[model samples]
Target: MIEASLPALNRRRFLWGAGAGAVTAAALLPGAARADGHAETVGAVMDGMVRDHNFQGVVALGRGGRIRTARAVGMAQIAQGIPMRTDTPLGIASISKRLTAVAVMRLVEQGALSLDARITTWLPDYRADVGARLTLRRLLSNSSGAPNPFRAAVAAEPALLQPPWIDTGEAVRRFATGDLVFEPGARFDYVLSNWILVLAIIETVTGQPYREAMRALVLDPLRMRHTTPVAPSEAMSYRTVSPPVEWINPRPPFLAAAGGYYSTAADLLRFAHGVYDTDFLSPTSRTALTTVEVASDSYALGGRMRTVAIGGAEVRAAWETGNTNGYRSVLGHRLDGRGAVVILNNNAISQRTMDAFAEALLRADAGVA
Candidate 1:
């Protein structure tokens, strides 16, 4: 239910950092909030996991409101031999969706738009008719019926990996004026165009570009210093990097509102804390962020998940996945905020493994593991 084609990014030179880890028994456990508790064991466990998967990147664990453990495995820039570290920046693909959703909700809170109102009321430049009836709610919940934008772009332009000289603008254009595969609120298609449009709404109502508005509304508020949108000219794109094992080259800026943000595991944990704690939005907006507006097994605002297997058991948890360029990430937290996990990878091999890790953490917190 979660498969999608990835975009291309030119493999370039990169930098790396030292690795560290935290063990289950370390003093750095979430309860202690001490950075010293589990660093060694966590580093070893994560490094072993990375080697086992033949994946390169960094992994960090944040629990009890502090970064208890962080480790970078493999070289960040193979050419330069840079090791991964807790502060190493990595692209977080779809995880960007949650931030975008938060930006849109901020607008909703400001009365710039209504979730139930037709999006056409906000975006008059688009060419779709059903769009006139599509609501911000439908788009946020994946109920908007636009088909996947990359497929159409690939259909028109074969080499989508290169510079946007042709493919980039065309892809955004096809989506900007594309047909709706299903009426708003009919069924779930998990297309990439929905949040792109939501971004347009944020820009329209707030009179700021999506990147700037996102920074102001989400990142800045959460103090996510390492997180930023992927722009075409960003130096990170040219930094030689490893390939993601599961998925590859999920474009950053091209898929901006849907996917396309970078951050460290520490940064993501802070973002999760803000989401669960509502440090950025009001009480009403916070309720709206987690409200299950759609019927999918997993998918909310920018995150996706209904249930997860943890500690040899199924647990209810909300989560998000990201894959782009040479980076991948996972962010999940229990609704109660007692448990949350962030895994950022330079390759795609960590999704399932991170899920297992998250489950274990949940079990430990739930006293079931």
Candidate 2:
């Protein structure tokens, strides 16, 4: 069900940190006098979501390098009665694409890979004609024109969802080799094959597995200790809230880079600080990572650059969302480094709803009515 919209505020009245009226109102709210109102506002929205949408997961709000709200509601594993916790790792789905993009940019910064170079430079074993035509930038921006065979194959045969585990190179050779659906870089065509080929390139350039390279390049440095490419055994997803029926989503190992990592809301907030608030990435790489490569999709290298209305002010933010199986997540942070909202849920929720909830949280955090 779609949530009712939050009360509208004047865009010109409330700037991020400069609004006197907002600060005074935040100081007047009960239990928000000491805090930045992030805790109070985020908690209220989360409580409503849990009651209305059966949201079962963790949420963390961050500002000025500190976590203001980190809360978990409902159950992580309903059958076992395992309650959700702020640290509980849940599948982040396509948000992994953002992480993968960061890893690729790190390589670019190190001179290990070039965005404009043909993918064949690293993946010589790939199909000559196709690889020669594709580049790292095209693949990262989802304009490679590579077709997604897994989606069709899984739809036709559900059993294929649990395909045998294959190494990155073998998986790329088998599934990523295909005729271009459109001219490379002419337009955006978001498909899993682009990320699959990206993983192969990372492997070739780094001489390490995708998971290890990512841990070294992004996760470890960001102190995201709870994040992992491998899904946890105890984490169970749900399709509905009324009856709480289980939804078993199988993720083959080869597709980890595309959408198969488990993370906590706190860890994701940590990622936001590292990527947006710190100098973890070089200036050149950071600019490329956030620059919108496709205007139609608002897609940059790994995530989307979005302009959202917050407290009447037009705010540019880095927005990344993931929805696969019964899991859904959102990581939205302002480009100005004022604040961020991270929501991770195991019970299936529509991406549109999740995006709205995240935005509402951001608005409330800023003390906009």
Candidate 3:
């Protein structure tokens, strides 16, 4: 059975910085834990959130392969009164971007793809003028000029916003013919449509569906058995606003490659570690996959990488926050195998509170008082 309780833990190390790109390298370091206590100090804070009903999923922290703290609180299905278990699968939301990026990077390593190549190389029939100028690098970095379709689609065809009618190819075919917000690679402008094209590229090159490809390239090796494209009926996503009721989510196959997977906090912790592992990627490929292409952008392949201050020293870390409908989640991992924080909430809890809980764990692990 899934664990639903937080356990006491003893932390011995902490991470201080994220790897490459706009992040300063000097910030990466590992420090010994403080003598004040074990890493379980954040347990009380989490319990408070549960008591107040501010959260309804899982929170976990660990180093290497060992978990220091793990807890599940609130209802997975409030209507059914089914309590959320630590292993309960919850929508991971946009964190899927990181996974998609990794899948693309794996292809790049196999010589089947290239980062600097233009979209036309893969989707020769793309036929769009912008497609000629947009490169994989730009798409990976969110610097592509593609317009974000999430908001506009909701307005134009709110009813059609469901994933069935809006798969990746459909989204790409719609947006590729549309207009560009600015010149490709002009600067950072987040656009959901970029990844649709990415998913399209993946399919065109590999000739396999997103699910099959993702399983072979990422899920299998990482041992993330429970993470998969969400089926609205199998999961209950809550709304953060007034009514506070279960909200059904749609998973367009194409967008699923970007933000449609449902995963457990435990599985996400495994993914956090997967991003830093070179076992599946060569040294050169791993560097390309994780390094930032711009000096001002924190976005690496899919998530952001940056430096944080701790006890007057810098530490590098890679992290991402994802939300959809009523679910919000955060995964923060240090590169040196020193620390990581994974939290998933189902009630639209404040992201800051989650960050605080995670940072407290990092600090406690680092002996930073």
**Cα lDDT tens digits for candidate 3, 1-369:** 112342321110111111111112122222344312443345445555554545567777666644455666656776665666666778888888888888888999888899888789998878658777888888888888787767776688776655356655667777545678888767887677778888889988889988889998899888888899955343487774234477777766767766888887667877777667546667776676568765576777777775656567777777777877777888888776688878887777777776666666676556564
> Candidate 1's residue-wise lDDT over 130-164, tens digit each?
66777787888888886566666767866665554
On residues 1-369, what C-alpha lDDT tens digit does candidate 2 reach at each position?
112332231111111112111122243333735464545565577667765665667776777545665666667777776766666789899999999999998888899999999988998878899888999899999998987787776678665556667677767866788888899988988788998899988888899988899999999999899899777766788897447798887877778888989987767888887887788898888899889999999999878888889877899999999999899999999989988988888888889999988988888778774
On a 0 to 100 scale, what is the lDDT of residue 282 in model 3?
73
Residue 235, candidate 1: C-alpha displacement in angstroms: 9.8
lDDT of predicted model 1: 0.63
lDDT ranking from best candidate downward = 2, 3, 1
Better of 2 and 3 by lDDT: 2
TM-score of predicted structure 3 = 0.84
Q: Give the lowest summed-lDDT range of ten residues in model 2.
A: 12-21
Error at 347, model 3, angstroms: 0.6
Candidate 3 segments whose C-alpha is farther than 4 A from its true place: 1-36, 48-53, 163-167, 232-234, 240-243, 294-297
Model 3 residue 107 lDDT score: 91
Which pairs clash inside model 2? 11-312
The CA root-mean-square deviation of candidate 1, after full C-alpha superposition on the true structure, stands at: 7.4
- By lDDT, who's the top model here? 2
